[model samples]
Target: MSTILIIEQVLNGLQSGVMLFLMAAGLTLIFGVMGLINLAHGSLYMVGAFAAAAVAGVTGSFVLALIAALAAAALAGAVIEVAVIRRLYDSDHLDQVLATFALILIFSEGTRWVFGSFPLFLDIPDALSGPVTLPGGIQYPLYRLALIGVGLLVAFGLWLLIERTRIGIQIRAGENDREMIAALGVDISKLYTLVFALGAALAGLAGALVGAIQSVQVGMGEPVLILAFVVIVIGGIGSIKGAFIGALLVGLTDTLVGIFLPEVLKLFMDAAPATSAGSSIASMSIYILMSLVLIWRPSGLFGARA
Candidate 1:
């Protein structure tokens, strides 16, 4: 591939990686802090997208759409944590999984009822609608570039929140020993709710940002959710640093492989066959990477030893 094309693909990878990080960061936090295996997290993502779409359609303001997305997802998360997830805290992993799975169904059906089966569209703001030239004379979409910036800013903000703030200390303590923190006067229940809401807000932000590019439709979150799970698995559950690293790795590998695999295969076989085979292999690249990571580090790249 040409240098410009390669640069473009790398940018795409970074954008994809950033979005995945947003998803995985929340997931890892919820899993680590709450010890709850939530299959319904994706449903929250869908909720965000729908909220953003609906608001944007009405107000024609991306900012308002994002605000709506964050509010709706966080509110939904808090409600779920209080009404349903709170009951499953002491239950086994299987119970949590089953409960959350039911929640996914409920969310999906409810959304479809309200929004119908059609997809919603989100428009890119005029300010970010055009292309910009890079230092190397490469032109790139301003919106996507802005997305990368947003992701990086959020990541930094999360780091500060988790590592530098008082609540951050409590969160870390809870991750280490939930009962101990509770005994020490921390309101564990409230902490759990905050973490859940924070996660939901992050998911919502991701959904709103991505909705401008992709169709906002029911079930759109499932695929991204699966990838987010893969990211946390590869990164090490509960490790934000690991999640960020793993997200970038998966994103780059997937993007680069998809672009180059076909060209490489064409060198060895017929064009059509090569294209199909390459595409299939590209699709499997991330999974293959996950398998390898698991083989090398069963607990994940940064997971604590049992």
Candidate 2:
């Protein structure tokens, strides 16, 4: 029974990892192609959640709300790419960070102004609201399992887009040498917009899916954004495969630690101390894993040697 419990926690971790991968994929690609670090990526995530919540509130249809969420995020991404982000394309990382930092402020205040301070709620569609049993009597929420399926499908679709398409060729080339690729007559401006939109859509989707489980509110993206950064750093920037693996590792580690640590600690200490110690250590597991990875590889598991 204890073993089954551990397995369930591990599954939960994997599910979390799948969600992280969805966010990390877009982020890593944007960084890889544009050499821009977008702190406002989380804001896009928040936007999607709000879009879904608002649309669902009005339409009373979760499917329509999800579509609106993706579309709104993509449109916003493109507009930002044109209006604000393009200005920082040739500037230093400091400029990019500052500019995106301002974006976070704008997004947060703007969202609050529109939605007010209270969080908006999103409901899972009825068809997916129940639980299902897997082998070995493992029970899981249907919606959560659906999210994993959607994430894997998206990952595969992105892989096909990046690895096989003509635009993908340009993206890969740009990553290799941006100036040289432009010299070869590629429309660098359009490519950047597309990449930005793609990343935004992914973030938006993540937000929409997670909103069903958590409340949709302002500044919700920041914590996940930080975790996404850690995911890419550990998985290897510019490597989609690395992001997938890293996200899964992080999700699993976090989930397992959260569940197992208290029990492990209890074996040696009192319940109160064990619980406190377990909670603290579990919260830090991903960062601890990240530090260990850096100490060992410096560049990350799949990162190119720098």
Candidate 3:
């Protein structure tokens, strides 16, 4: 393959990685701070996509659509946290899992019922509808490039929020000793709701951005949710830095392997079988990477030594 092709694929990987980071960041935050196993997080993502699609269809303003997505998902998350998730905090992992899984069914069915089982499409804004030429004559979609920028900005903002703010201190404290923070006068319940809403908003933003590139439909978040889980696992359960690095690693591995593996195999085997074998392996590359990472560091790359 040509250097240009390689660069393009790398960019594609980065784009994919950043988007995964958006999803993983929130997931890690929620799990890290709340100790809740939320299977329905992805459903929040779907809600955002649907909300954005609905708003865009009615208003023809992508910005408004994005706002709607963030608001809708955040609202949904806060409501669920208050109405259902709060009850599971002291429950066992099995209970948490079962409760959240039920939430997933509720969200999926509810979305299907409202949207009538039809897929919704969000159009790329006129400003971001074309490809732009890079320094090396590489043409990449402007919207995708925008997604990377937005993801990075959000990551930076999150870092500042976690490392440089009062709430950050509370969140860190909560993760280590929730009782201590609560005793110190922090409203633990409110903090939990805020964190959950924040996480859901991030997922929602990701969904809105990606909706333009793909069909917005019920169950769309499940596949991305799986990848996000892998990302957090490889990065560490509650570490934002870990999530970013892990996401990039998985994204590059997935994209580059799928693209180049077959070509490499063709050197030693028939084209057809090489393509088949390459695809099979490519699909498993992220899991293989996760296993390798676990072997090297059981707690994940940035997870506390435990």
Candidate 4:
């Protein structure tokens, strides 16, 4: 590939990575703080996309759509936390998984009932619809670049929240010792609700942002959810920093491999076979990376040792 092509792919990788970070960050936070295996998290992502699309269709305002997305997802999260998740805290992972998986079905059906079976398209705002030129004459999508910036800013803000603020301290402490914190009068139930809502809002934001680039529809979050899980596992279950780095690694590996692996294989095989093989191998690249990382560090890149 040419230098420009490589640069573009790298930027694409970064964009993908950042989006994954948005999804994975929330997943990690929820898992880290609550020790809950939430399969319904992706449902909240769908909720956001649907909310944003509905609001945007009505108001024609991207900003308002985003706000709606956050509000809707957070509301859904809080409701579930109170109605369902609260009951799962002391339950085993199997029960949590089963309950959340049921939630996924309910969410999917509920969304279909409300939005119908059709996919909705979210338009890019005029301000970010065009491509911009970079220093090396690289033209990139402004909206995608904006996504990267937003993800990074959120990451920074999350770090500050966890490291510098009282709530952050409680979250961290809860992750380490929930009972102790509860004993210390930390209104653990409220904190759990807040964390779940915050995580849901983040997932919703990701869904809304990505919906502009892709179609917004029920079950849209499932695929992304799988990737987010991979990111968290590779990054270490409860580490935001690890999630960020792992997301970048996964995004870069996925994008670069999908594009260049075929070229590399073509050197040794015919184009058709090479393309097929490359595509197959590329699909597993992230999982392979995960396996390798596990071999190197069982707890994940940033996960605390057990």
State each model's C-alpha RMSD to the native: 0.9, 1.1, 0.7, 0.7
Which ten-residue region of model 4 has the weakest summed lDDT? 297-306
- After superposing candidate 2, which stretches have Cα over 4 Å from the reference? none
Q: Given candidate 4, what's the lDDT at residue 245? A: 98
Pick by lDDT: 2 or 3, better one: 3
Off by over 4 Å in 1: none
Candidate lDDT scores, in order, read: 0.93, 0.91, 0.94, 0.94
RMSD of 4: 0.7
Give candidate 3's error at residue 1 in angstroms: 0.8
lDDT of 4 by residue, 1-306 (tens): 789999999999999999899899989999999999888989999999999999999999999999999999999999999999999999999999999999999999999999999999788889999999999999999999999999899899999999999999999999999999999999999999999999999999999999999989889989999999999999999899999999999999999999999999999999999999999999999999999999999999999844
Tens digit per residue, CA lDDT, model 3, 1-306: 788899999999999999999899999999899888788889999999999999999999999999999999999999999999999999988999999999999999999999988899799999999999998999999998998899899999999999999999899999998999999999999999999999999999999999989999999999999999999999999898999999999889999999999999999999999999999999999999999999999999999745
Q: Model 1 scores what on Cα lDDT?
A: 0.93
State the lDDT of candidate 2 residue by residue for 66-152, as single tens digits: 898899889889999999999998999999999999999999999999999999989999989988998989888999889889989
Which pairs of residues have clashing backbones in candidate 1? none
**Which parts of model 4 have CA positions greater than 4 angstroms off?**
none
lDDT of candidate 1 at residue 26, scale 0 to 100: 91
TM-score of 4: 0.99
